[model samples]
Target chain A: SLSTSAASESDADELQKEQQARSVLRENFLRCLLSAASKNVQFNMYEKVKMEAKFGACDIDVLNFQVSDLHTPIGVQKEALIRSQDVISFTFEI
Target chain B: MEGGWPLLGPLQWVRYVKKQVKVKVGRNEEVRGWLFTVDPVSASMVLVDFMESEGTLVQVVMGHAVEEVQVLKEPDRKIADRLQSMFLPPRTSILDP
Candidate 1:
């Protein structure tokens, strides 16, 4: 029982450390997202699909990206919601 | 999202912050920049590449798409300070005499 308690205590400590790291990292990321607002961003998606749009916002869960003036090969869309699952990466100048 | 890089925990992810890294994404994409931060929730990485006379370019590589990550260089004290201050609100000190 002593060894079990010790293990549990260490697990708790590890969890706390992980949570602290997560919070700090998430805070900086949120700030980066905020700074990227209104900037021209290029989104690289699957299937070799690439498009440029004005950076708008990403949901808290990062499930989707809300962009403005999305430029597609066919035509330009005034607004668009891109599912995060389809995106490989995105770039913007700050 | 379910495998590969996503399996890495916060501690491992935090180790890459503030270091210059080269990230391999998808099949044919390679990105390099100063590792700013990684979103623990989505595992996305925020990278900043400073361009001469132009501006800073920020790239966010989705966690699910990361195939590999290589630490290229470590930031010096000055570069670290710059990276940390990039998005921070300017500090206004109050003098207490």
Candidate 2:
């Protein structure tokens, strides 16, 4: 009984540590996203598709990004929503 | 590896913080930078690269597209401090009248 209780207690501590780490990482990431707002960002998508747009905001699920003046291969779109799955990475200056 | 990066939990993801890593996204896409932070919810990684003439450059590699991530090297104290300050505001100075 003692060993079982000790093991469960250690498990709880590990879970707490993991949660703290997640919160810190998520906070810093949110801060980075906030700084990216209003800045110009270049998105590199699949199939060699690259475009630049004014960084706006991403949805809560991080599934789509709302951008303005999206530069595409054909022409510049006034507004667009970029699916996160289509994008591999995005670059911007801080 | 169980859907690659997205499967890595917070404890494992935190190990890459402050270290230099090379991330492979899709075909022919490889990026190297300091591991600033990884979003646990989205599993995206925020990378920072510093340049002399130019300012710091930030890159966010999506979690779904990450093919592989390899730790290249570890950052020194100075480099870690620089990485942490990139998005933070400048500290206020105390006034002595």
Candidate 3:
């Protein structure tokens, strides 16, 4: 019983360390998104498709990106939501 | 690297921070930059590329799209400082008053 309790204590310690790491990483990522707001961002998508749009905001789930003036091959859309699954990467200048 | 990237928990992903990484994404695109942070929720990586002239480029590679990640270099003291301060607000003087 003593060994089992010690093991559980260590597990709790590990979990706490992981939570700390997650919070730090998440905070920095949120700052990155904040800095990217209103800048022109280039999105690289599947099938070698590339598009540019003014950066807006990303949902908390990170599933969708709300953008403006999305430049497509055909024409520009005044506003749009780009599915995160369709995008490989996106870049913006700071 | 590929399938397990998004599943790599924050504890694992944080190990890559403050280093230089080369990420392979999509078909043939490879992005090289200083590793900043990886979003714990999505596992997306925020990379910073410092240009010669001015300004920095920030690239975010979705976790699902990453094929491979390679560690190129570790950050020096100066680079680590820069990376940490990239998104920080300008410091205000508290002693002025």
Candidate 4:
């Protein structure tokens, strides 16, 4: 059906947007983390960022960004899985 | 609503542009339609448009009769609060100025 095709296309678009937004959020998070680390802020973090895009009633998909870090990269990569909330929701629809 | 002036300290209130704040500048006789653009500047505000009597353009500082800011919408506060929390490091020092 045409509506189905359109829905598929929209879904694809949403995924693309989500990834892009997530990348940006990750970039910013990394920048801050690096900046703070460079300044020696006493936090030794090594974790991953999770970005989820959820559509609202107004067709706006809010990017929910969650960031977590550990003292060692190996901790997140292979040891354990945990996430913290310096998270923020960014609305990307207009 | 917050974080823009040196008074507000070093904080990123605006990710792109400074906030638009509605304000009534001047005393009883010297007031009219005025829209204020607030940023971290020595000047109180940059007047965008004023639909009132013609007078020499002047700065609007709190001491110079600028009224207390009134946040019109909750979104304004939400955005401001978000910006505030985003930049707050876990251990900000008292030596920071």
Candidate 5:
């Protein structure tokens, strides 16, 4: 019984540690996103496509980015939603 | 790295924070910067690159596009402090009476 209780205690400890790490990571990430708002961002997409847009907000799920003045090859879109799946990476100056 | 990257979970991802990393994205692109944070939900990585000029560059690599991540170097105290305060709001200073 003592051994079983100790095991359970360790499991709870591990869970708590994991939760703390998750929260820290998430908070920093959210802050990063907040700082990125309104900055000019360059997006690297699939098929060697590179474009720039005014950084907007991203959905909670990180599925879509709401951008403005999206520069496509043909022309610029005043407003656009770029799916996260189509993007490889993006950069912005801070 | 590879398919297991997104599944590395929070604990594993946290280990990479404050370290300089070289991340391989897509087929051939590589990015190098200080590891800021990794979104647990989406597994996206935020990297900060200090430039010669005053401003810094921030790069966000989507989770699904990551091919490999290599730890290049660990941060010293100064760098760690810089990374911690990079996105933080400026704190008010206390006045001496």
Candidate 6:
């Protein structure tokens, strides 16, 4: 019984770690992709991200943001896409 | 900021996106490209494998367009299709901001 309890605790901890890792991965992935997508701009990288996904059917989101003329900042307000069991996400602030 | 491809009407948007959106394009950027199935309301830009007609996809945002449109004509459609499958099993890595 003690061994079973210890194993359960370990499993719980492992699950928590996995969830946190996934969250971190999401944050890191967005930052890199957005940094590259926005390129050189004054895009204030907001920490809030709206995300969604699915295993089938492709979802698309399009927008026209007027950030600036000379320094056009490609600010991705929010994005989510899922098709073919994969996901495409984006997030930024204007 | 830079202007976006208004895509004009939905029909026009469809027609232009049938192929692949031209990348590195800027204002007045007019190149035939495929509109990704990003969302119900918005459209994402991507390159579809011509052979499979359903495979690997590279989501190229409109903002990625810089100045001169860079259109690559010779990507092995077969390989492109196979490689695109790697992007499937949708999972939101980044929460939308």
Q: In candidate 4 chain A, where is summed lDDT lowest over 10 consecutive residues?
A: A85-94
lDDT of 4 by residue, B1-97 (tens): 3232324311221222224344443332222212222223221332222225752232222212344433333335644443333334556533345
The candidate maximizing lDDT is: 5
Write one digit per residue (lDDT tens) for candidate 5, span A18-53: 999999999999999999899999999999999999
Scoring model 1 with DockQ, what do you get?
A: 0.85
Candidate 2 per-residue lDDT over residues B1-97, each given as its tens digit: 3247989889999899999999988886799999999989889999999878887899999998888899999999899878766676455222212
Give per-residue CA lDDT, model 2, range A20-66, as digits (tens).
Answer: 99998998898898889999999999989999999999986789999
Docking class for model 1 is high
lDDT of 1 by residue, A1-94 (tens): 9999999999999999999999999999998888888999999999999999998999999999999999987889999999999999999987
Candidate 4 clashing pairs, residues 3+ apart or interchain: A46-A70
When sorted by lDDT, best at the front, the candidate numbers are: 5, 3, 2, 1, 6, 4
| DockQ values, each candidate | 0.85, 0.87, 0.92, 0.01, 0.95, 0.04
Per-prediction interface RMSD in Å: 0.8, 0.7, 0.6, 19.1, 0.4, 14.5
| Fnat per predicted structure, each in turn | 0.88, 0.88, 0.99, 0.00, 0.96, 0.06
Per-residue CA lDDT of candidate 6, range A12-71, in tens?
Answer: 997776555445333332332333343222221123222322111122223332222222
Instruction: Flag the better candidate by lDDT, 2 or 4.
Output: 2
Alpha-carbon deviation at A19 in model 1, angstroms? 0.9
Cα displacement (Å) at residue A8, model 2: 1.3
lDDT of each: 0.89, 0.89, 0.90, 0.31, 0.93, 0.34
For each candidate in turn, the TM-score is 0.90, 0.93, 0.93, 0.26, 0.95, 0.27
Candidate that scores best on DockQ: 5
Residue A64 in candidate 1, Cα distance off native in Å: 0.6
